[model samples]
Target: MAITHFTSSNSFQGYHITQQFDFCSGFGQFIDEDGNPASFSMAKERAMQQMLRAVPTEANAIIGFRVEHSIGSYVHSDYNNCILTNLITCVLVSGTPVRMEKDMEQKMEKVLLVMDYPPALPIRPYLVTLIPGQNESTLVQLRFFSYTSEPISALQADIVLRTVFGEDIVLPDIGFARIRAQDGEHQTGFFRVNLSDSLFSAQSASVRIKKYVCGSALREGDVHNQRIDMRLEDLFDLKRLYGNDAVAPHVVYEGGWQCLCGAQNPTDEKTCPYCQRGGESRQVAHASLLRQAEELHSACEILACLQAYEAEHKGSLPLTFMEGLEKMASTERMFGNMKKECMKFLHEHLEAEEAAAPADVPDLSEEDQAAMGSDAEIPILTPNPTGDGDTAAPETEEDRFTIKSPFDDPYWK
Candidate 1:
């Protein structure tokens, strides 16, 4: 009889069973990165466990199975953040709970789903550039590499800038979901947004993607976020004295442009006090060297050593950093002559160790082995090679209660 035609007087119990699980909830309202309900598998497992207990004690499995799960959203107050939507997973199943033959086995092929989310974001942020805006504002754009078609939502970042003179400005909560100058195939997801109300007098900016959030996932930007903060070629030493051929030159700054190196120099000393190079010559060479350093380090990535070193130290570069960079410049000259001698010693030591390799096995005496019970004979049971699960072993001359091989178990063939 159909389930719809069933009556309360004639209840169906042994033929089938249904289990309903309590609602399960996870952290986020939307599906996870793999596009799966976060707690579906968990709830389904719980329902299956409950059904197994409610079925007849003699039943081995539920054959005609039907498992169901769904997602739902509801607004609720969360202690961690503002009011947010809660995603829930509910599961239920109905099946014919029956006891199968002891030797039963299904040969049908089944497919299981596996998913991987190698990267949290579909696009990798490559570069962020800022320029003058149309209405006395700042226009910022973020260039990114898009390898997947998945859409990223609620993408926001925090950018810092330097205004004219020496004032700093921060543009937090900036949106970069707008597609501009983007080619998903050849180029990337170039995102742009006009800061309608920005620092109009900002001359040059120092931009880095220090913080960003994608969807509901909180992630920190990589150190390479400053791919092009402020190009060295565009830098200007702008406090010119008189525009004559040589009537005073270079920016007349109070602290000077040696990354604030010469702090001991007089307040009026625009440049280093001990430098011999002319003002114009040193400024131009320093700017050129910066560009060359950036270009060279892009390929070798040697500059990352200092950046990582600084982070490891948890503050500015150590005193050893400046002293070591200057002293280690000629380390090749100091170590060049010792290479041959060091290699020869290393080779000889390696060969000696190889020639005198130690044996791995133990070398215990025969009498010691016998005393330790190593020579005792151990009885082993042989598995029945060719027989159905119902086949019984012939009566053995040994004890009747002797342990049997795992293959002889009633559940096995």
Candidate 2:
């Protein structure tokens, strides 16, 4: 049979004066004293007044006050378990002043709500640079990659990253997901920042790199770790410094003479937009390097497919969809293999970034370098393809249990 448990706090029945104590309105009376119950009422008011005086001016009420009166050794047939428990009654109430007790109770409830909700994430230290632009105000794009299984909802993401990195800085609210620059078929999202902000005065007028990971679900007990290596370069247009409405027109060399791309109506003129080298190679060299990296990684798959196509057509490429599908089967196998390999490569790459990152970048102060010897001791970061290092799910808590913070998001810290 399942065992049933009961505590002294539970209700009981019976009558016994094993220990008689009465604190009825407030002048307490023990078995040794025979004080009038009416006289206790005046004492209660006096005690409440003394408590109000101790309360701070701003405090509406003092909470967690409990008074217990017990009459022990009472036995009756109603006491089912032969446990002659004490006849103890506890009267619990807050110590709010008579003048403002009700309003204070309401305020106390509001404080409880705030405590229930998690705190806002602290903005990480970062540098912002304005790439001159006046594009669509809507569709703010923020692209980042993480190795975490627990995905952060759009509601959890902070639209702004504010910090006191160089000077106390606040960045302008720019919309997400607007095209900035294009190279052949490649394009990236534009980031608009204000140049007038004083926070970036001491630092480069350019956006510097600052990396951080998010997700509160990562802190559950006995969790495996997941390293999130986000490639922001893939999402942001690094080369497009000038916007459509740049005050200072871009100047570039064309035919050995410098020219601008967007000046005047170049589209209507069918001429070089601003300045062109006309055959001077419009594509940036860095774009070629990035493309090469992607191509090199996908080379095995692409080559395998191309070879299969040649074999089926006897040296000629397939034109029909059915013929193409047959040739593409070999390529898909190679593609799957390449995808697995690429993830392994990416994991190694992120580990390198983590190792290279400075171990101690102190909060605000620059000179107290001595405080950082231990903090600067860099930990060994190795590639983790499994990503089970820190991605454990959180346990389910009851609805009545109030959590001050959920999901250990670095922002909350």
Candidate 3:
């Protein structure tokens, strides 16, 4: 007879077991006639039949095998399987996360006004108050004396007043800065500064407000090292929008399936491979959904950028969905091309290895070695010298390919 016991740590793919129960009656307890103790084989068969009947007729469910065991006897000398029955369950799960993020990105597609420094500096943490027509037209007060001892020169100090305020105005006084060029050329992308002793030395500086330009500023949340505490409902809401069906309704928190899926789980389960839908084989659909969600998220980012630009520039608008998708397609194509180029390099490397596998070294005689060592004897020029007067020098051919650093030799100096 086939063994009735089964132990699988994880849910097998393609099956679904929603619930299970184990019923064991104590010895000498059951007096009901209909619930009489049956033989082990009969009890096991009946248990199997029960599971078979539980399988959903309308939809698929895991009904692999059901075993009934006799733990102890009930009102009898011998143990009976019917009175001490144990039940096991299994199920299949499926889903993908494609539609959720797309909806979210679209919903939150708003322009964000911000400010940025050229050399990516930490947030100044202090606020600056400025006046347009009064008090030297503009004032910037630092929280404390800067590390640089000398008052930062107008050439070195740059202040970019950003607000997503105006896209067309060529900002004056605030757009010039000492921009160090990588290739020995100077540039002024934006912002020129005028530091004042009153603004710098005073505990605080306040000035009349005037016209200002604006740009995007990184937020506290944008900081790389900051910890994030996100709510599960929000995560699930996002997932649901993106069509993440694999997101389990019942999150197993403490024991199993503990991976975070943008959702907070209070408990966990050892094997959550079963869903209302089915098992592991269906997980591929969910993987594809995740990919879709990522794409949608990126699309949202582009939309946000457009909105930011529009906010800064009046009469502007965000790109159409199709236009954004075209850009995305182009980006994907470029990425694909880059991947192919990388693969080509790997292939070339393998080919080079194969070609070099049987490489041979040419034997050099003593004379050849001596000739290679002494370069002073070798002629720098023959009769056909390009320079002005040079007597015909001995022309001894030597390998000039021997590696040497140009800086290593003092002759160049």
Best by lDDT: 1
- Model 3 alpha-carbon miss at residue 197, Å: 72
lDDT of each: 0.37, 0.28, 0.28
Q: Which lDDT value does model 2 have at 214?
A: 26
RMSD of each: 34.6, 22.5, 32.6
Weakest 10 consecutive residues, lDDT, candidate 2? 108-117
lDDT (tens digit, per residue) of candidate 1 on 11-78:
23443333323222222123333346447776776776665556655544444466666777766666
lDDT of 3 by residue, 80-163 (tens): 444443332222212110111111111111111112111111211112233222233332222111112122211222223333
How much is the lDDT of residue 160 in candidate 2?
32
Clashing pairs in 1: none
TM-scores for candidates 1 onward, in order: 0.21, 0.22, 0.14
Q: How close is candidate 3 to the true structure, as a TM-score?
A: 0.14
Residue 184 lDDT, candidate 1, scale 0-100? 30
lDDT (Cα, tens digit) per residue for candidate 2, span 281-331: 222222222333345445354445445545655633324522433343446
